[model samples]
Target: MVSTPSPSAAPGAGAAAPVAGTGPARPRWRRRPGWIPAPPLRGRRRVPWATSAAVFVLQQAGTGFAAHNERAAEAVGPDGAARLLLTLGPLLLLARYRLPRTALFGTSAVTLAYLAAGYPYGPVLLGVVVAGFAALVAGYRYATWSALGMLWLGNLLVAHAFHRLLPPGGDPPGSWGTDLFMLVWMVALCTAGELARVRRAERERRQRETAEAERRRADEERLRIARELHDVLAHSISVINVQAGVGLALLDSDPAQARTALTTIKTASKEALGEVRQVLDTLRAPGDAPRAPAPGLDRLAELSEQAASVGLRVTTETEGAPVPLPPGADLAAFRVVQEALTNVVRHSGSRTALVRIRYGAVAMELLVDDEGPATGTGPTGGGNGLVGMRERAAAFGGTVEAGPRPGGGFRVLATIPLPPEEGGAPLQ
Candidate 1:
């Protein structure tokens, strides 16, 4: 699935809409327009063998014609079998893309043989050069360098073997200037091939890094959504479940109390649905306005009221000078209190819960305690509530300790660090 980018989404804002059924939203730049011509639906297009054959014929014919017209004085024009052999040398390049190493070695060997057989060094060198480039681009570094070495050695051997075939007063075999020129030529070709290879390798490395980064980002987003779902569903469903049970138990005996329970259940379910909707809205088109602000510490009183309706009395107290907190830290603290109190109602068998919030110089601390029997099945015992609390605190460079109180009940303590800037400002 491919999602079109919203025109109003800011570049690099990561505001692209996620494609339905796709795991994560792809970057806008990676999305191409539908009208752009795509590659063949089948596999990659095969090499044009006929075009290669035509090029080879033209090159050989041109080289032969140039040599016959005395335009290439240094070239020893080959005749009969020698000419055919020289022509066949470059023909090996037809399979260069598919069989790079083999083509490179074959072309190099054939070119060497032709030169050694006293044939002219004409356009045949073109095939060797192309093969070398193909091998380098295919990442056959050792093969390319080795072929180049052999070619240089063969050039020297041929020059020595046919020294008498040279024009009058020509540079002799192993001449320093001639050797230097040949070395420079070979090095230049090798350098060009190496540069191309390096560029291709760098591009591939960057692509791999990008893919890994995207995968990690996707994993983090999945975990974040899971945490939000757990918090919303668990607390609301637990409240509804308890309220429903209460409503059923008192349906006939006490109609008024049962009606209250049903009302609580309805309210909790509606709130839960709204929060879930907000989370889902994140997947909407990027141009949409942001959802409502997340639930935070200011909602603590409201959360306590909800717990009270579920038969768990919660008292919230704040110590130290009140200070503003970052949204994430505030939300984490709120969830810790909310989850702790929900456990008190559902598992701790506690009648009353105390939630303490302390603003310290370096950290904001939260403590929730209930004087209930510790033997009940509470959220602290192998439940995701405690795990989620720890995850939340840890996300903000904080820590959470949750367990049974030594006296009779359960306790949850969380400490979230306050960044320097946030710590400096007191709540208005």
Candidate 2:
């Protein structure tokens, strides 16, 4: 009895063998042991509201202290109402991500009211900065800019009015230098917010493009696999079906012919299995060795021989000198020939088939004809073979035509183009 191999006996089985000096392989980015706990790897976490609260508290306290010491501006001193407004302004920022526009406009309005009431100018500006950034990130460009413009203009008017009211010996009020400084500060904030928004949008666009490319690659791979499977299975199964029928018919009267038919079926099935395995191996990891080269036009002789073994006499004729072809075009030419011959064996009911290849300056043409009567039926009963041939040709900027011959049988003709570098060569 045959025995199956054990897991350890399989190639590359068990644990990976150690390198001569490196022991087991370790990932380069693996974390080293340390006292500090590693950060959690969960996707982006929400910012804590306490952080915003802390910033607001510090800014208010510092600003309030600065305002209380200013002798020129008695209106700048903080009171119960100012403290309440400061607290509420930062609190609105906690929901900035979900309601960015609301938070931004609300905070801007609050800051304006606070300034108009003559409150100190410490951390109160932080609210407007944070809200503006949030609004920009949320894609409210026009509204954010409009709000900032109005606020800057209002600040200028308020500062000028307050400056005129200052006592002669009091601390100097808003000046040209201060106005320029505020303008620079607001511009810097808006510029930073705009840059950040642009960067984020670019990142998202790249991610979307990458996903679309991957999806297209997957679709192309699936189409390739389908074509390979259909070609391999259809050709081999067609041969096997014919041979099996012959074997059954001859089993009672001619044991020798029956044995030959059985042998042909076995050979065809084995070849089909090997080709299928090769196609499947393409799906493995990239580090694996490359698969064997796919069969091309050079293998047409073997294909014709296989058809001959199934009682179809397939004669191949070449009209031009051989020329190098791109892998896709080469493979497509071979498949067109293969599927045509398979049709002759399965549906034509004729003893002879003819295949002609013509190489030209810009394209290669294939013509397969049989002398059997036209039956309007294909191998699969729905003309899937013809559809497959057309698709394969179209992939290489080629075309296929399959129809009834004028006199008797069916014929298939295909023309596949050559790439620019390899075209226009004389027959050698």
Candidate 3:
């Protein structure tokens, strides 16, 4: 089982780990203590060929310069084999991105062998530094640590235990101060590698979070558009269906009435088309002003007229002085009332509905009632009308209660909380 950090541990302690078959792990802390901040890497693509060539040229020139100095006189001068060893380290760096551990170990081994051969040191260790950094960033923290440890151990064995077996005849045992300095440099390099690993992990995590947030926003917008289309189509189609039935029944008995029914159907279809086109325009060019203003409670009279044309008498009554509402609340309230009355026309045996609007100091209530022995084939809970009404009201921190009334009718009540600016003086 993989062990995770405790709750009180530092943030990002449990970043993604390397999977099996990718690399070996020790199952301890991946990010060591004492973070040293590294600047963010600018580019993603690793030009391994370019990097390998650059490092090889720089190391050859740098080592030659160091060899000419008097300080390296005690060290063995570069020869054919020493130059070959120096070349090997940089060549191994070509595989650093794809196989970081391989590059690190190969470079470290070649550099160690050169030191064991008693060659003057300069930029020869550059390959090991670069490979170790890449390995840690690739989530091979333990492997990097082990490779570095082996290099340090190899240095100790060469300076003390295996010096006679190596080159530079009559050399003294290495000083403790020199070993201490090398140790400090290794620790610093490892510290730098750990910092880079953590920073890269953090950057990747933030990118994933940003992408997830965008996905959720897209899902919500799609759902909102779907609800809008459903509301628009359901009511308009119900009206058209009723008018078409009336026109069919009256075609032989009353031609004028049949013509009237056809006109109603035409008007309903035209309005429905206009609303659908407006909704579609939002998709084609979002953030542009809508070609038509959205429908709201101010259009309640128009809604009542549409219902009346289909043999449903809708009586509307206002209890308190009305105040302006936010655009979202106004649209939601209108849809709730529209869907409620649509349900009445399609499902209820009674041809009447009563709509009541009451305005309070900080809330607006809409109550739609229809006397009914539900006669149509529509299912009460299986349709989208009630669900859409509830979702809309909930979006504005409101509630929708829809069910059978206490006595004998179906009722839908939506209570929407008003924003502070829209909540006028208390109603009397």
Q: How many steric overlaps are in each model, in order? A: 0, 1, 0
Residue 147 lDDT in model 3? 91
Which number leads on TM-score? Answer: 3
Judge candidate 2 at residue 146 and give its lDDT.
81
Candidate 1 — which residues are off by over 4 angstroms? 1-58, 69-91, 94-98, 162-180, 375-379, 424-428
What would the per-residue lDDT of candidate 1 be over residues 93-154, giving only the tens digit for each residue?
77776677888899888877776655555566677778888777766777888997998887
Per-model CA lDDT versus the true structure: 0.72, 0.74, 0.79
| Residue ranges of candidate 2 with Cα displaced over 4 Å | 1-51, 72-75, 161-176, 287-289, 374-382, 425-428
1 or 3, greater by TM-score: 3
Worst 10 residues of 2 by lDDT: 11-20
Off by over 4 Å in 3: 1-47, 70-73, 175-181, 424-428
Q: Give residue 93's error in model 3 in angstroms.
A: 2.4
Local accuracy of candidate 3 as per-residue lDDT tens digits, 159-234: 8998877778866677778778778888888889888878887986787799999999889888788888888888
User: TM-score of the candidate numbered 3?
Assistant: 0.83
